[model samples]
Structures are given as structure tokens and as C-alpha cells.
Target: MTLFKTVDATELQARKTAAEEQFRGRKSGIDHFAGNDPVTGRPVGGYVEGGIEAVLVKYAEDLIPVYVEYTTKGYTLTSVGVVSINSSTWEIYMNRPAEQVKPLLDAILQKVEDDYIAEIEVYNNAIVDKAVAEQLAMAERREAKELEEATKARRERIESEVRQGLKAPDLTKPKSGKK
Candidate 1:
């Protein structure tokens, strides 16, 4: 005897729609700027944005079936996924009863959530990298400016000494009479 229940197309579609809505609600609840550096505890700027392209439901009526399918540092990226019940069938089969449709949907949405989190990490890293690079470049520019100013000041001091009849002694020549 099979435990799997056969759902009609309309019922399956309704369930799929509800699942998609739930996914959207979850996605919307996520804080777009909630990323933080693990080491520093500072806010790393990145946005979490994506959409559900499509949600597919599989109706097993004594048959089988199957399926499947980033964000800003400076540039914005769009991501879309086609979430289907069959893709997570193995997980659902192993973890929950096949007749329980909600669990199956939840499993698929959980995968989607995991993917979203991964993308958020990627964007956070990118933002941090860009900020670090900018800081390094600023430091270099400041150092170069200081060096140039010091060189100019030294040159002015030397010129002033020469004007006041103080000449630097030449060490490359032999003494006048002790050659």
C-alpha cells in the first residue's frame, strides 16, 4: 500500500501559490542591511534581494516526476529561482511523510533561504574588500604627500644656508696640501 495521496491540479496549484506567498513573506521580512562582520561586529553594507520566478508542484498519481534551477558591492544583481516540490522529494521522503505537502514546500523554501544567505555573505565580503582597498589607497596618497612636503622643506632650508654663505664641504676632493 502507498502512503502518497493524489492531489488534483487545482489543489496542487493552490498549495503552490500559498507556498510561494509564504516564501515571499519570509524574503520580505529579511533585513536588507543586516549583514555584520564576524570579526569586527561592524555593519558591512550589502543588500539581500531576489524573487521567486516560479513555484512548481508535482502531483504523483501512480507516476513519477522530477526538476530544477547576488547583490551589491557597487553594482546591483538580480536572482531568480524556480522552486519545485520534486526537487526536494528525497529530503521530504527521508525527513517527512510524502502525504504532508507543507513539509515538502518548507524544505524547498529552506534551500532557497540557504542560497540567499550565501549570496548575502558574498556581497558582504565584496563590500568589505572595496572599503579596505579605498582605505589603503588613501593612506598611500597621504604618505606620498607628506614625503613631497618634506622634500620641499629640506630643499628650501638648504637654499637658505647657501645664500647665507654656508656651503656644504665637498668630501670627494683631497685636502688642499695633503694630497
Candidate 2:
């Protein structure tokens, strides 16, 4: 069983206002209407009270583009502006002073760049050291091989001379056949 009653516009509006105030006083953050999601046509969370919605709309219209641009460029919003029904535009404030903030962010970026450059320098130095060590090792090997070849050549020449001296007549040794 269900009961239906018709209420006048003024009475209904008064009741809505009371309800919105009650809910807002008790709750925190944005209040969402059950079936009145602005973007989607479905029910979502709790309902947004009329006053909050108006303020939100005003802020979005004026500052949404600014917020989007800042965020797209990798910046964070530090503060939200005060909302007023009389004002046409919304004002947003930053958490940090512009003078202090810019230098801090720049310093951080500069430090990262410096660290990367230092790492590259270390890697380049390691490469140079490795190349020098390889060159020295190759030179030493070349010298050792040249010395071995020279020694072998000297030994062969000495053996050839001894054989020639033996084959030729020697005054100190007597001949096998008498002259």
C-alpha cells in the first residue's frame, strides 16, 4: 500500500532547502544527489545540495580551464578559491609563494641534470681506462713476440756457422787421408 499527497511549489521548495541544509551540516565534502549526476544520467553517491552545486558550477566555469592547463603542464593546485554567488569569476590561490616556489622546483630539476652528467662522466672515464689498459697489454705482447723471434733467428745463425766450420778443413784436427 502507498499514500500520495500533493504539495504546493512554495512548501516543496522550503522542504528541499531544509533537507539540503540538514544534510550539509551533518556531512563533509561534496554532496551528490542520488539520481542527479550532472555528467551521467544515473544515480551516484548522495545528492548535491543546491547551494553547493551553484558554487561548484561557478568555480568550474571560471577556473576549470586554468586548472587543466596547470595540471597538464605537470603542476599541482595548491589551493582553492572562496566561492560567492555575487562574483562572476572564481579566484584560486597557490600554497607556496611564486617567488619561493619557482626557485625550489628549478633547483630540483638542476640537481637531477647535474647527477646525470656526473654519471656519464664516470662511465666515460671507465671506458678510457679500459682502452688504455688494453693498448698496454697489446704492446707488451708484441714486444715479447718480437724478442722470441729475434732469439730464434740468432740460434739458427749460430748453428749454421758451426756446421760450416766443421765441414771445412781444420788445421788443429788431423785429416782422415794423407796429402
Candidate 3:
């Protein structure tokens, strides 16, 4: 008989539907399309048909060129081989069933989410650093202005004291006899 368990058309369809449902739930976090449907005015759903390629187009468009290579041994397609997914320079080789497209898409989506979070963190840190630096500079300038004003006030006080001393009568001088 056959080495592998046979999968009927109905079973395959059910598996595909389940996979699509899983994808729909997971895609909510990263879904950028927030437009409403033209016909009903309701929000557009995020489900796309046509297997892995469709999922990639709808969700992971940026991570394009995610190649899936399926190999069949003979004319009857008895022996199905491994699936290779190449995303950019990184290559993932797995022996997963071709019908299970959700797991592969899930992995890519996870990567996208992680990278997005890291980018946001970096941006926030930069803004905080810039704000702190601006505050420090402003404080330094205020301190310098206060110091300059204090020095000027001290100099004016010393000058006024010297002028008062000069204007005062000399005690050692004798009075005029004619007075």
C-alpha cells in the first residue's frame, strides 16, 4: 500500500480554512490597512486567499522574495519533498507539509513585529536624550547669566564706596582763620 496517510479534498480544505483563521487572529496587531469596504461601508477584512503568496502580499509585503520551493519526485507526485523558504539573505529549510502555510507566515510576522518594537524603542530613547540635553544647556545658560549679574553688582558697589570716600572732608586739615 502507501507509506503516507492519504488526505482527502475535504480534509485539505478544512486545514486551509483553519490556517486562515489563525492568520486572521494573529494579523490584527500588524495590520496597516484600516479602510472600510466600498460596498457595505464596513471595515475590510484582512483575509486573502491563494495560499502562502497571498498571505505574504497582505501582511508581510516588505519581506518580499520569500520563496517557497515545493518538489515532487515523480509524475504521480507520490513523494513530496522539503519546503525551502528564502527571505532575504536568511534561508529556512523545513520539512513541514505544504498545506501548513500559517506557521511560516507566523514566523515572518513575528520577526517584523520584533524589529518594529526595537525601532520604536530606539526612536523614543533618542527623543529623551535630546530633551535632556536641551534642558541641561538651558540651565547652564541661566547660571552663567546670574553669575555675570552678581559680578556687575559687586563692581558697582565697590565704585560707589570709593567715590563716597573721596567726597568726604579731610579731618587732619585745620579750619580757616577768616571764618
Candidate 4:
């Protein structure tokens, strides 16, 4: 489940607050986040405190894309509701005009120009990890093979010297056929 998608009016405002100039190169946001992630040294995905999505884009301030979700019931609007917490922020306060929301959202296009879907995976897939581990294991096996080859060469040298002291081969033997 995702919120603040499509870069709608409210999301545009949140983008403005976060600033598009900052989100360059990196992923936009997570599906859900619950505070920071220790493994990645970033925030984890789930839901931020107070049911808001707060992310600190690269070199940008925190983007709190507060949102709502309405589940349409059969007919009588039984489950018309909202999600995300609309609350205070420490930075400058912002409130949009009801009529000019579109224009305001449009203005953000100048700063952002275009938006792409942000994809973030929580863990490295098993296949990816397996490939990496296999590569590492192959490297170790190669090293072991080289070490074994070196030991074999040394052993052959030592054995050859011992055999030479016991009985050396005749260097001058009769030629099979005279030229």
C-alpha cells in the first residue's frame, strides 16, 4: 500500500517543502517507514510516527507527505475516510489556497521537471546474496588451489633432492644411434 503517489496537489506541496533539487539520483521514498534503519543507515519503511511519511532527501529537508485514503463502499459512502496525520512541523508553516491548488502543484514541475517511481527493497534478494557468496567462495577456492599447487611444487623439489642423494641418474649414456 502506497500513499502520496502521482505527485498530486498535496504531495506537490510536500515535495516543495522537501525540495526537488535534493532528491536527484537517489530513490524518492519508501513504501512505508518507521523511523531510521540501522542496517542501511537510513529510515525503515512502514509508517513514520503520527502516521506521516517523513524522509530527508539528499541535501534536502524532511519531506512529510501527509495524505488520506478513501475506501469506497458499496453505495452510500460508508467508508469515506482519510489517512496520514496532518500536523505541525518545526520548519516554516505552509497552507495552500483551495482554488489555486492546481497552479501550485504545476509550479513544482519547474523545480522537479519530471518524477519517476521510487523503488526501494528492504533486503537483498536471496538470489543476489547467493551470487555474491558464490563469487566469494570461488575466490577462496582459487586461492586454495594456488596454495596447493605451490605446496606440491615444493614437495616435488624436496623429494627429488632426497632421491638424487640416494642414487643419481647416469648423465653420460651410450647414444642409441650414432650420427
Q: Candidate 4 local accuracy as lDDT?
A: 0.44
Clashes of each: 0, 8, 0, 6
Candidate 4: residue 74 Cα off by (Å) = 14
Model 4 TM-score, all chains together: 0.28
Worst 10 residues of 3 by lDDT: 73-82
Against the hidden reference, what TM-scores do the models get?
0.35, 0.37, 0.37, 0.28
What are the root-mean-square deviations of the candidates from the true structure over C-alphas?
20.5, 27.1, 19.5, 17.1
Query: Which has the better TM-score: candidate 2, or candidate 4?
Result: 2
Once fitted onto the true fold, the runs of candidate 3 whose alpha carbons sit more than 4 angstroms away are 1-104, 165-179
- Pick by TM-score: 1 or 2, better one: 2
Consecutive 10-residue window with the lowest summed lDDT within model 1: 68-77
lDDT of 1 by residue, 111-171 (tens): 6556555666677677778989999999999999999999999999989888678666777
lDDT of 2 by residue, 72-166 (tens): 54544433444444556554432333443445445544555565556666776777789899999999999999999999999999988997988
Top candidate (TM-score): 3
Model 3, TM vs. native = 0.37
| Candidate 3 per-residue lDDT over residues 86-176, each given as its tens digit | 4333222223344454566566555555655566667767777898999999999999999999999999999889879888776789988
Candidate 1 residue pairs in clash (backbone atoms < 3 Å): none
Clashing pairs in 3: none
In model 2, where do residues sit more than 4 Å from their true spots? 1-95, 162-179
If both were scored by TM-score, which would come out higher, candidate 1 or candidate 4?
Answer: 1
